[model samples]
Target: MTSASLGMAHTSSQAAILDVIRAAGTISRVELTRATGLTGATISTVVRRLINEGLVLEVGRAESTGGKPRMLLQLDPTARFAIGVHLDHAGITYVVSNLGGAIVTRWRQPGAGSDSPAEVVARIVREIGGMIARTGIDRSRVLGLGVVSPGPITAAVGMVLTPPSMESWTEYPLAEALEDGVGVPVLLDNDATASAVGEYWAGGIEPTSAFAALYMGTGIGAGVLVNGTVYRGASSNSGEIGHICVDIDGPPCWCGSRGCVEILAGPAAVVTAARAAGLDVGPAERSVAESFAAVARAALRGEPTAAAILQRSARYLAVAAHTLANIMDLDLVVLTGPSFALAGSLYLPAVEDLLSTAFFARQSHPVRVTISTNASDSAAVGAAALVLQSELAPRQSGARLQAELGPEPVPAQGRTSVVGSLG
Candidate 1:
């Protein structure tokens, strides 16, 4: 075999082994051999390489099966670190996590309201430095920076396409700017996809055959995970549940669609409905997070109008969930993001009820819908998970894989629907 082929084969094998070890929590070399279908000698060689790289460590001895007790191998959670940045108009959330996707440090700041691209990039670089210093993590041990933003992105170009929620960030070179500024590799993915990955790594949703993460912020989107990896459609913008038409002639969305889930059920839509019902949603200048919380609070307090508005939003979200479950045949739906922090109590049972009753394969396989306990920071944590995924798993789906391995590495604006994903 050729030298290049040999190198790629070794890398792939090593990565696969590391992933198994990670998923297993603590495993012995014999168990790895059994799981990987690799020879004992090959497992030994790869495990040795990983140990030398500081990626894996020998924790202790496992129970003896027959011969001498085998040594247990596990990932060195502190061996490397990654940073995740969630960029939105309301605010920016930064998370620094170890190799095992444990948060070591975190910071939250006002987002790029009207700042230039350069200014946003500079702020990210400075904060990244601060996080490393505060956590006492050596700069060289940091893997890379992963930035999650409202999407309609061209991941290959590392650009954030014009997501309506953030008008000032049209076609911005976010990944490149951050990579150059921070002096580390940068990966830019939509918040939904990152959230799904985070759910898998940190939220204990791994080994699942298929599931979807519904990220509800100012807008809503989904991250489809089929076989433990994100299903990024043609343009790396697959999961725009927000733009799905739930009502034929309901409300006009900013995406030029009628009755999109975003227009009918997103935080903005809920707040608007609350306002129309004479509920106090505070001033328009306040952040989406705050206004959404206010509406949720009013509903929780049993205000009839506010409760009715929230019910309507929940119904629309159920439409989205039903649609996704029928099409993707998903086994699970995780409702997450900042908007769900307060309103999830309202959305959970409503959507779950709809799915149980209306899903196409409900009789054959019941689809489970649950709310993320980490709704407020799942995206940021997921962004950190993205770095872990990129390094360890290197997703074979999405424009990212195509960009890295396809014939040409140019960005393509491949659209899957009337509008692309919004976060």
Candidate 2:
């Protein structure tokens, strides 16, 4: 073969080796050679380059199989870091995490409701700077920033087109403005997609399973994962479960639909219902715990009116969940986001009951519905995961901060590690 052709072949082989290492976590050179069907010489050369680039490190020696001990190689999880920001009508959450999705630093601030696009972007830039300073992580090693916001979003242009509850942020250039302020790559995605990715990375689930993430926050959205990859539909807006109409002649929704899931079960609907039932819902500035306590207290105190309002909301949410289960035919569904923290008790059982009884595949399959252990902050974590994924496996459109930050070094063979084993 020509010399140029040989060079191209070698480059492709090295990329394949990196892919294997990223999947395996910690692997010996001999094992890598066997896994990739590459020559020992090629593996050694690639490993040397990876080490020189500070991406791979020789962690320790591997078990001896009646022969010389092999040196184990691992991806330097701390070699780089990424920032995740969750933007909602309720608040703004920022998280600094390593490649493995472990949180190193986090900050939560009041919601950016009335703030203009520029004002909110400036605040976000300031908060991110503070987070980086507090963590003492090198700016060079920080990959980029990922922002998860309420949908529906125009992912192609990085804009929050029209968030149902966040009326002040119509057509906001959130991603572009943040990128300009921070001088780094920024990605904007649906909050549900971010929550789903967070659950996929942090929730110990079967790697091969198809899962659905139903996030109930200011409004409802669903994130679908099939075979370990997020499925963003044609417009990158697939998970608008809130607009799904279940009651044609019922309450009108902000989206001009009658009895949509959001109108029937979102916080606005519940709070409105509660207020109409003669209970004080409390001020808007209190902690989420206080708000949830209000709901729980009203429900547990034998106030039939308050209890009836929550039950109605829960029942509507269950209908949405059942619709999602039938459409996705998923094996697992995870409930997440701040709204679910207190309301889950009222919603979870109703969903489980409905799915067990009326799901399209009820007789042929069983659907598991569970609340996320990381409910309060799943979207923020998923935003971090978005940065990690973009760094490790950039799409054809290329890295968001390609001009500012050079390509992330490929993870070494056997460098991927899960914090805990999956069931």
Candidate 3:
């Protein structure tokens, strides 16, 4: 065989073995051989390589089944680290995570509201350094930095097609700028997609065949996990549930659709409805996010007016949730994001009730519904997980992100519905 082919085969085998070890939590060499369908000799060679790479470690021995006890192999969670940052209109969040996708430390800062791209990038560089320094994590140990936000990320060009939310921060080279400042590779992805990956990697969430991380903030989107990996559809942006029409004659959306979920039921829509009704959510000067949160807080406080407002929004969201559950045949639905974090209590039962009784395949398997524990920081945490996923389990259904190139200046006049994705 050719030398290149031999090297490729060797690496593939090592990746396969490591994946099995990670999935099994702690496994013996004999079990790995069985799981991988590789010979004992091949497993031993690959495992030795993984151990040498500091990716796997020997944790005590398993119970003796027959001869001598076998050494249990497990992933070395601390062998690597990744930084995640979420850039948004309301807040910028940062988190440092270990190899196993568990957060080690986290920090929060003000969002990049009306700030120039250069100014925000400078702050991000400084904070990432602070996180690394305070956590005492060696710089070499950091695999990369993952950034998630609302812009249209075209991984190939490394240029973001800025969205209307971050209006002033357009035509900037986000990936190249950050990478140059931090001296580490940077990955830029949308918040909804990142949230789904975070849900998969988070220790708090249970594994399922199909699930959706429904992220609700200024807008609404879903990150779908099918068969343990993200399902990045045709254009690499599959889960924009917000654009789906929930009402034909409700209202027109920026996407040129009438009665889309975002316009009819998103946080902005909810806040607008509340204000129109003279509910004291907040003054007009307050940000939409703040007013929406105030409404949620009041709902939680058992105010009838507030409860009715949030409940109406939840019902609209539940329509989208039910439609998603039926189409995906999902076994789990995780509500997350800034809006869901504050108002999940109102949204939960509405979604749960519909899925329980109305799901198409309820007889086969009942779907479960819950809120994301990291809802507030899901994008940031998932951004870190993207780094770990690329290094550890590179095998996925969708295409990998293309190598980034020099950034191009693009106008935000027309933003495409689809963006880059991690699949």
Name the candidate that leads on lDDT: 1
Candidate 3 lDDT at 416 equals: 22
Select the stronger candidate by lDDT from 1 and 3: 1
Model 2 residue pairs with clashes: 21-413, 21-414, 25-414, 25-415, 25-416, 26-414
The TM-score values for the models, in the order shown, are: 0.91, 0.81, 0.88
For model 1, the stretches where C-alpha displacement exceeds 4 angstroms are 1-11, 156-161, 398-402, 406-423
List the candidate numbers ranked by lDDT, top first.
Answer: 1, 3, 2
lDDT of 3 by residue, 302-377 (tens): 9888899888888888888899999989988999998998899899999999889899999999988999999888
Candidate 3 deviant stretches above 4 angstroms: 1-11, 156-163, 203-208, 403-423
Q: Report lDDT (CA) for all predictions.
A: 0.77, 0.71, 0.76
Q: Model 2: runs farther than 4 Å from truth?
A: 1-49, 65-71, 155-160, 283-293, 296-307, 362-364, 394-423
Candidate 1 residue 3 Cα shift, in angstroms, is 27
Q: Which tens-of-lDDT digit does each residue in 53-96 have in candidate 1? A: 88899999988878999999999998888898998888899999
Clashing pairs in 3: none
**Candidate 1 vs candidate 3, TM-score winner:** 1
Greater lDDT among 2 and 3 belongs to 3
Candidates 2 and 3 compared: the better one by TM-score is: 3
